[model samples]
Target: MRVSAKSDYALRALIEMTNRTAERAVSAEELGRAQEVPSGFLQAILADLRRAGIVRSQRGQSGGWRLATEPTAVSVADVIRAVDGPLVSVYDMRPESVRYQASAEVLQHVWIAARVALREVFEEVTLAQLASGDLPDAVTARTAHEDAWQSH
Candidate 1:
């Protein structure tokens, strides 16, 4: 599955927030700058996260953004879905919702399986783990194989 720029930027911003002082909100300009994402694009992504209830914004001179919930409570998958919608979609439809005719019917199963595989990793990882530089064992194991790094 392809990861959208929105999703990547959102995750980067969220992880950066996790590393900062929770008592104070971080401004959009700061987040965008630190994450190396465009200010306008990051603003839209932050707004999406706010709408998804993953983040909360403040106003006034101290106005900025903060996580709506604990970092441990927010999964990578949650961030992706909040910004980019479904983990896997075929023509903007859920994998299970898509139908293939004839021999191509098996393609449906392939999509479903692909989604499952993505969930196993994305759902298993949380913002806290990422911020602390401590990935889950399952994730680390996958990365331990040199073949996993090679581009086909």
Candidate 2:
């Protein structure tokens, strides 16, 4: 399972915004520059986030984007969902929804299990936790191991 570019860009932009005052909106240009993401793609991601209620936009001469809720209240999973569709998808379908023959029946459970493991990390981590460089104990433990840093 891997995060899509949209989700990655959204999270990076959110982290950038996390450092600013909630009342102070950041422009797409600024966010794009800060995160090195394409401004056009970032704008589209931010619009989706706004529609999802994850971020709010102010339209006018003095307008920009801001988080709808506190940084700590926003979870990585939430941002991912707001930008991408689902956490994990198998062949463009949910693992539970797919049917298989008796030999492959157990595969559904395997995919679901994969999703569960992803949630354990993403859902447990909040934006504030990431910005502070103090992840939850579970996440920290996962990173503490040298193997965790290695690309499989």
User: Which candidate gets the maximum lDDT versus the true structure?
Assistant: 1
Clashes of each: 0, 0
lDDT of 2: 0.90
Q: Model 2 over residues 1-152: C-alpha lDDT tens digits?
A: 88799999999999898878564788999999999999999999999999889889998877899889888899999999888878888888888899999999999999999999999999999889878888999988988889988997
Task: Quantify all predictions' global Cα lDDT against the true fold.
Answer: 0.94, 0.90
What TM-score does structure 2 among the candidates reach?
0.96
Worst 10 residues of 1 by lDDT: 20-29
Model 2's C-alpha root-mean-square deviation from the true structure amounts to 1.0
| Colliding residue pairs in candidate 2 | none
Best by TM-score: 1
| Residue 113 error, candidate 2, Å | 0.5
TM-score of each: 0.98, 0.96
Model 1 pairs whose backbones collide = none
lDDT, candidate 1, 42-115, per-residue tens: 99999999999999999999999999999999999999999999999999999889887888999999999999
Q: Candidate 1 regions off by >4 Å?
A: none
